[model samples]
Target: MSDRQRLLTVAFYLAKFNDEAVRNLGYVNFREAFNELGAKLDYSPNSVKNRRDDFDPLFGHRAGWHQIELSKSNLEIVEAFDHLSEEALRAIVFDLLDESSSKQGVLLADIVQGRQAPSYTTRGVTGKKAEAFFINWFQDHFPQDNLIDTRDFGCGYDFGVIGSNEVYEVKGLSGIDGGVLFTDKEWKVAAELQDEYHLVLVKDCFGEEPTVEIYSNPHEKFSPKKQVSTTININWGISVSEFNELDKE
Candidate 1:
């Protein structure tokens, strides 16, 4: 199944229990949920756990504070809706499953980064907000420039600019010195695209106004080593000392 489909399946599975599960809230056992979801979805228990890892943050619910498993190496926890009402959660899940491209886009962005930092949950909704902020700023300054959202393509880049023959891997950082995480696919894309690939850093995104730093030909500027088999980490402040600052409104 496609990544989109897998996420939708998970959403669908969760919605099934909304009526009865609402009562459990903070007390629902994750194992029970996983068993039913995995059985219906034909997924392994581990897969259900993995999907919940992504869902916990999206749903704005966490159970680690209460349900703790000493035997499970990863510390199995059960999380349920806390931020939104059960009805609201069901509505959102339905919206996502109804082929809502925009909603899917937002959720996909959150999932792309894997389990998000807890601080991100505290900040606001989906990563698309930050990405859109930067895109808007870029469009305002370079009105003639054409751009394409490459996020759905999973091409390791967020956007592609026409005429410039360049693609951008956009990152939303908390500050100028914040960390930027890239997937292995992005690194490979950057290596292959080389000078044609750029890294657009959108910093101070959670603030009233955000600043953008565009690193043209990032593959030539930053040397990012693999953090894991699938992730790459780059410290922007240390790698690119000089980058053109885009004027923001």
Candidate 2:
């Protein structure tokens, strides 16, 4: 499924729960919930409400668009998440929205290099928010061709713009000036792709107005200093006896 479809499915599920979903997500009301989620998902607020109304009939919360049948995508969503309890489904939604958690592996590498990792919450800009900004900006500035989301592929770049060889790596900052972190794989890919790779920075992402700065061939544009540190790595293992003892407990 496309990233947008996944987001729509999440919104549909949230709509199924109605007011409870709004409360659980920390929104004062459905309007606020729709607006916030719309921004994060790079969709219009009305679209979110439409998706919600599409699913509302199934739950019998209110008179929704009962004239039309559920689309194949909506049916798939129901089949997939129908078995989950409200809490479990909400947890899944929360995890999907918490894009910062995806950086844990990169943060570990930074720690190994003796660099202090920045707290995600303190940054005041989340990965999802930055990505949404980039998506909207790309759609506006670039050709109308598709921009494929490669985040789940573990690729160095976050998006591959169709009809071109260019790949975009997005970084979000609360302000115009701030340090951006890169993973080893991303660095290597940037060097390999050279001019084909682009570094897209979204600045002032937490503010009403966000700005986009694009650098083509970032590896050639900036020379980054590499830091190394010698540290002991610890690994813990349990034997069969220990496992059995723990299992008994």
Candidate 3:
């Protein structure tokens, strides 16, 4: 990449990380990653300006102008954050996921990342460097039953339910080495809405047999790497009726 593009890429990921960090109140890793990338892209410390303005009428001030200005013409490429190769994208995304946990409290963090999977990871998690793997995988394989009411927004890998009596949160665990990851904030939400959280473990290259488990409650017994709350709000009882069977074993 040209120096200009490199500069822009650093700025771009920096902004992305910062945005999420703010959501997390202030993530040190996000700040650190932002700083690291900023330096790598040859952005001097002064280059980062942490505010956007609404000076223009048509469009409000955009964030990360210093970096975004690189792709002034290819708006879509910049907008999509799709400039990176598949591996690069995954690495960047994983970093985002990693930093997110610290933002939320400990319980929330655990709920998000502590999702369980089979001890064995399937071919579904690893393979050729498919850049659009999650997108394509979902579009190709997710349940298309209209009666089931599944839909794709051409958005990111995370998918959700609609109405009140709704069911799950199916995020693509594709391309991961079979471990699970989630932001602490997301985990808090999942634990709060545990009845709906589902880890769409698409393995065997997202083969037909994707592992499906509905987590209506966070496991109290299992230890979380980091939780969203300072105090543990663990559920000692196996509440999910489905899990009651497993509890007995």
Candidate 1 TM-score to native = 0.46
Q: Mind giving the per-residue lDDT tens digits that candidate 2 earns over 67-155?
A: 44455456445545555677767765675566665453343233333233332222112456688888988888875678999988979
For model 1, how does the per-residue alpha-carbon lDDT over 26-97 read when each residue is reduced to its tens digit? 225667767655555566766766655443332335422112111111111112222344455545444443
Output the TM-score of candidate 3.
0.28
C-alpha lDDT of all candidate models, in order: 0.54, 0.70, 0.37
Worst 10 residues of 3 by lDDT: 51-60
Per-candidate TM-scores read 0.46, 0.48, 0.28
Question: How many Å off is the CA of 241 in candidate 1?
Answer: 64
Off by over 4 Å in 3: 1-157, 173-177, 206-215, 218-222, 227-249
CA RMSD of all predictions: 19.0, 15.9, 19.1
Distance from true location, Cα of 233 in model 3, Å: 32
| Model 1, runs deviating above 4 Å | 1-126, 229-249
Decide which is better by TM-score, 2 or 3: 2
Rank the models by TM-score, top first. Answer: 2, 1, 3
